[model samples]
Target: MPLRRLLAPLGAGLLLLSAACGGGGEDGDRPEPRRPESSDPAEGAAELMADMSLEEKVGQLLVPVVQGTTAEENADLIEDHHPGGFIYFPDNLSDVEQITGLSNGLQDLATGSGAGVPLFLGVDQEQGMVSRLPVGTRFPDAMAVGATRDPEAAASLAGTTAEELTALGLNLDYAPVADVNVNPDNPVIGIRSFGSDPALVGEMMTAEARAFEEGGVVPVAKHFPGHGDTDVDSHTGLPTIDKPREEWERVDLPPFEQAVDADIDAIMTAHVFMPELDDSGEPSTLSENVITGILRGELGYDGVVSTDALNMEGVRQTHDDGEIAVRAVLAGADQLLMPPDVEAAHSAVTAAVEEGRISEERLEESVLRVLELKLERGLYDAEPADAAAASDVLGGEEHAAAARDVADASVTLLRNEGGVLPLEEGSAVRVIGSGSEEIGAALRDKGYALADSASAADTVVVGTDGARGDAEQKGLVADARASGTPVVVVAQGNPYDIAELPDLDGYLATYSSVDVSREAAARVLAGEVDPSGRLPVDIPGTDLEFGDGLSY
Candidate 1:
């Protein structure tokens, strides 16, 4: 097959502008990897595909988001659009029983639909601010896990997360964020990435991917090509990475490469624009040059290639929901995730196939990948997840213990000036900041005396997670330190928040405000657990460097 470029105007010149954006020929001619001799998922997928109608096949290309807290509430969308999969958000969740029932009911609907296929239920359970379901044991985010600097621990954490997700009837988890946080001011990727070092991020992502596989759930290593260097959040607007190709490969591509090599189930494309790959200013989620030319042609990722949620303003700003779904399919994305208008997107794809715009062969390729993922999770032969057993597996003693271990391993004691840490028992400590009430309560649970004011305290402990700007917190820290009382700055958000504060008597970063992370930080400050977390990303322009952590 000759290299060919289509100038057919796919979502604002996504097809026309890039010469390298060639939609590859059929898979029959391509050098695909061999499937295992045993009746592998690919074989099962092939058999299933043979029996699917054109509408059923086109439906497999879409994975839409549905509103509602229960399966019955969401069943109409599934029954009407016939989406191959569903993505859940916190708004759609209530509790373990509700979500578990929702997943089971969705699968039942999908399985009994036009093609009788099981739905691939997925959620962004990245374990920190992005966690959707509230039933699982919450661990610290990716950066905190990276601070542990132990790939084995990272793997264990992901494995435990996978178990809880599977028990809830979810077969897919979008996690172990592969973006390397190279920019300190990066609006979205901070603390979500493993670190600034590409190699370390790569290693940690691989470990997490392997662990997810071990736990019988498909893991999606996401925001591919990368979202780390940009300061704009894609949820609001498109972010552009203006660096050269070499710099992108150096900083953003390694973890995704490693993930592909590790046979990750999926690599989700970011909504950011990489002009180095495609100058059309289209988000990578709709750019064939980035998805096919780079991810497929260069990296050789044969697994499912999913788009980041199509509803995000990054991609949505330029294209309507229907157009976004069509262009993403043309760009070689195997899954269209969370289109804003599911009905419009589904109808558009069905029409594109019927009008000879998107080739049936092309539709088949993506459907095969989608079905293979479902078959890999054993959805065909398996029964709906045991919702009754969700209580036994989620947040159980073992899961809690594992969370505590990871949390304890990830506490970074950034500054301990004048040996002020390990405060004596019953020391009068004043706690303040966002979530300060919870942090203070955790301290009280550990037998620390709470002080009413900075002037009356032996020490003032300020807990913040950058949820609000740090200037106010910084002023409070400065005033507390000026009063001649010792001040302990507990960074409950990004550790880099320390750079904005005055030098203090003690500094600690928990990298998250999750219950487990907060408890671990409390124990560390109370002289119980050791502070062992190392820095993943450096505090820009500060003396701090990656791998910097102090212990008691």
Candidate 2:
């Protein structure tokens, strides 16, 4: 397997290109590291690749999650393994300065100040439900954006979020979930998707992708080929999408196609299996027909492709870490994300390339895509982000205002039976459920008196985290309704919470349980703002349609 001159068209104003090199020694150890003089990404990547070891080049194809909050905890791993990047989870981070210092420290160990290849420190800051950073502007979920029916709102927040992330030394974001999310009981992607409509989801994804790129963060439009219609969570078990090719195109693939049209730098593959697309029994993450045949050949996408976390049960159900790594590369993914065992995954890939099971061209193709995106984002020349500057940007007042706007706009008035809303800011109210005290305090701040009991209140405001199935929560709603007061339910989680409890006098769907969303629910109830958010998804057991919503 020999390194050859190769070039291919990819998005981001960058070409997937690498030049033949004579720099590495015959024994395959690297020479002294150096920076590229050329500003062009292709030339710069090639110049840097010229000094890489076969070990290093293989390492470039992997992005594993590190083990701790401080850089020293994972110091030996970074110094020894040479992973192209590392993913940040909540356990691996504590604050802005901590994460920033961790990234900067790790890079200093890996790259030695402009002497070696830099690291792609990344996170999954999708804002709602999946936000990894402990402190930041907690923007509402994609479904909240979907409720507003405006792609510009999605773009604006994404750009702002990108700036904040970059300020904290992160470069890649696995976000703006492109899944359609048509399943009402979808355990994984319920509020993550924009809406059920393919075109709208496509538009939102394209808008957010552009914003992330413009903000100097690589937004990887994800769960490719779509994971929207399933009822299972891939983190726990293997899920399968049984749609045929036509239905698959009609439902799941549109957003990804739109992502490609927007020239998204990367797309992540789903762990779920699609038999119609490929009946090989392999999940899409390990299927060549799905990745190479469908995504590359049929869709004409040339950017980087990454597998979802390989440590999950979805990808791990049938294979070990080593086999999963080898199969992912053969499946056309450029990055193997978070395999259970990084060393085994790395060693297996090396062995495969050495055994000629995976050709050098295939391996180099991934390496170039990884390098091309990193170089295109100016990561090669940029310094580690200023940790002290993070406080100024993360959870800024402006970002909070923007997030509030979306949250307020996404408050869907799912029901107003007997005109219970506009509950009069002075009404005596009793709020109960998860985050109930916050909702009660919000009303109290708005001049509404807090009632000690539902029986003494003018309106009983009940908050729920998908209480449609929770018996205790349902009993609370029932007791409130039994009190003969107008029981107004604020569904702070799933919109369908009101479907089973039809006796409730009013209902509001905020689409998220984040602080912004909780505050927005109060505003809508107090009539400080009108309910503008439409339904992104329908309440399956009731009459709520895809676009159903109301105002005061």
Candidate 3:
């Protein structure tokens, strides 16, 4: 047979197979089929996953940061890699309209690609220091929530947070920090944690998780196994958790167990290394003993496991970009979160599969689970949210009202002496400290006259830095002592800073710098709102130990 004749029948057979596969050619060549819109998104996802090649399957594991604000960047990521999800940062959110539009654009890109699964869009809205939606329903830190000792309040706040996040087309919240802040010097977990007690942390964790679930948002309990005891920040370097397994079982693992029991949708692994548990001295992101043995086998948590940001210095310093993704997958993580190099991650996983380091069955297990999550969240087949509706619901009047209520309820008043509080109306009051300006402005809004210097005032108000009282704080105390004015010191950081300035006439620890803390301070000073918030953690200076609260 001639060469042309021999090729003709082979080409015809190829066309028939393409037709059967629902792939048709562009300009007479076979193009991929569009993702089918189905009522049963899970079945649709399973069917689509079955058709994916090794490259596409591996691509599903890469959750890259989509750079730039345009749909073009998102479309490029989707068309090229077919990523399983998107993680939004503050930069990614300009407003409700912008975020909704961005999410719609990304979903359109995902659907246009051959993959049929809806992209899981996630954000870090844990409240206080790490909220992406700053303008949206700004609540007090987790510590403040814990101070209320009202799990119902925590759950209601979390539900309100979820309602706002979900209205903007975001389905996943990387929140409800479960770390028990045992070390007051802990650089990161400070006010972000519920409290130092594992049981209290567990109660708050369970409530927050339930609230998120009820609001139709997947809540992820994070920094797994705990990041509370370390002094170092993982963002700057790897923090080691050098404790015995028994200590971990008692102290660090309770909140996670509680969260898992509460049916939290996901668990995010911390990068801290616990040598006593893993022995390999590697961060949790790369250790099978930590992710597989402890989180899965020991704790018995069967939810989707995600890694902390792979771009962080802790994980990146130890493993190359490719190895980080591969190790996390092999370590039983269902998602490779925020890899510094997405292409390298894809290549690494593909090579690992070929080299038999990671089995196809393992890849399917993770990808299928991820797909199932997307389906369960109703991400697939749900229409893009209305722009007006998103604007109304996201950080709107209702959210602000809820935030104010939580702030009012969670504010703790730690002290009142000599009845110096309920600042005499029209009395000159000096507000001191970096946060004083903001706090003063809030007070002014309530018709209080606040002065800047102690010399001109009848009373001095100070913001204490929760850690140790530094030289600057000592200087402020000296000024307060010399002024002969009634001094009211409000420790905004942690109540622990109060030990440094015991000479003040009136001392109080609000335990947070958020609006709630400020409001609580103002109310206590004015004697309007009785300080019901007890000390969740002990004030360091007094003979009174941890968990002591005094009546005002």
TM-score of each: 0.91, 0.92, 0.89
Q: Give the per-residue lDDT of model 3 (tens digit) for 195-299.
A: 888999999988998899888888889888799999999998999988988998898899998987776788999989888878786788888898889888877
The sequence of per-residue lDDT tens digits that candidate 1 reaches over residues 1-552 is: 111112111211221111112111222221121223447788878887876678778788778775676555655565566678888888888887777667766655555445667778888888877788867788888888889999987898889988888888787888879999988788898888888999989999899988988888888898988999998999999998899999988888889989878888888999998888999889999999989888999889899998998888999876778888999999999988888887888889889999999999989999999988877867665545665688889958998999889989999998998888877788888988755777789888877889899988888888777833657777777778788888888887788777777678898988888888888888888889879899998887589999899988
Misplaced by over 4 Å in model 1 are: 1-38
Give one digit per residue, the lDDT tens place, for model 2 in 206-307.
Answer: 899899999999998989889999988999998988887899889888899898877799999999988998898889999999999989998889999989
Q: Rank by TM-score, highest first.
A: 2, 1, 3
Name every residue pair that clashes in candidate 3: 24-30, 24-31, 25-29, 25-30, 422-525, 422-526, 466-494
Give, for candidate 2, the lowest lDDT window spanning 10 residues. 11-20
Tell me how many clashing residue pairs each candidate has: 1, 0, 7
- State each model's CA lDDT, in order: 0.80, 0.82, 0.75
Between candidates 1 and 3, which one is better according to lDDT?
1
**Residue 183 lDDT, candidate 2, scale 0-100:** 85
